[model samples]
Target: MKTIYVTAIFIFMAVTVFAQGGPPATPIDGGLSFLLAAGGAYGAKKLMDRRKNK
Candidate 1:
């Protein structure tokens, strides 16, 4: 029983540490993606409006 408890704790710690390893996301990357999406949306809306008006 004691061995099982220790093994469980070790596995939990190992998974938690490994799961979190990654390059942290840069703020600029997020901002650029958001800006691109917003610009695309705006352009699409403008194009649709022009088409509708025509």
Candidate 2:
């Protein structure tokens, strides 16, 4: 409970800092690469979860 809240707050702060000009501009991809990477990561996580439950 308390640990979850602390982790959430820390992650929010980290993402906030990252969104504030942390990475260089991607002219060609136009942020599609980020979305693709996130999707792939999410899919991998789901697969891992299913495997773990089985």
What are the TM-scores, per candidate, against the unseen true structure? Answer: 0.50, 0.47
* Candidate that scores best on lDDT: 1
Model 1 is weakest, by summed lDDT over 10 consecutive residues, at 21-30
Between which residue pairs do clashes occur in model 2?
A: none
Candidates in order: C-alpha RMSD to true structure: 6.8, 20.6
Angstrom error at residue 14, model 2: 51
Q: Tens-digit lDDT track for model 1 on 1-54?
A: 999999999999999999896997667888899999999999999999999999
Q: Distance (Å) between predicted and true CA of 18, model 1?
A: 35
Q: Considering every candidate listed, which one attains the maximal TM-score? A: 1
Q: Any runs in candidate 2 off by more than 4 Å, and if so which? A: 1-28
Per-residue lDDT, model 2, residue 47, is 100
Write down the worst ten-residue block by lDDT for model 2. Answer: 21-30
lDDT against the true structure, per candidate, is: 0.95, 0.91
Which regions in candidate 1 have their CA more than 4 angstroms from the true location? 1-27
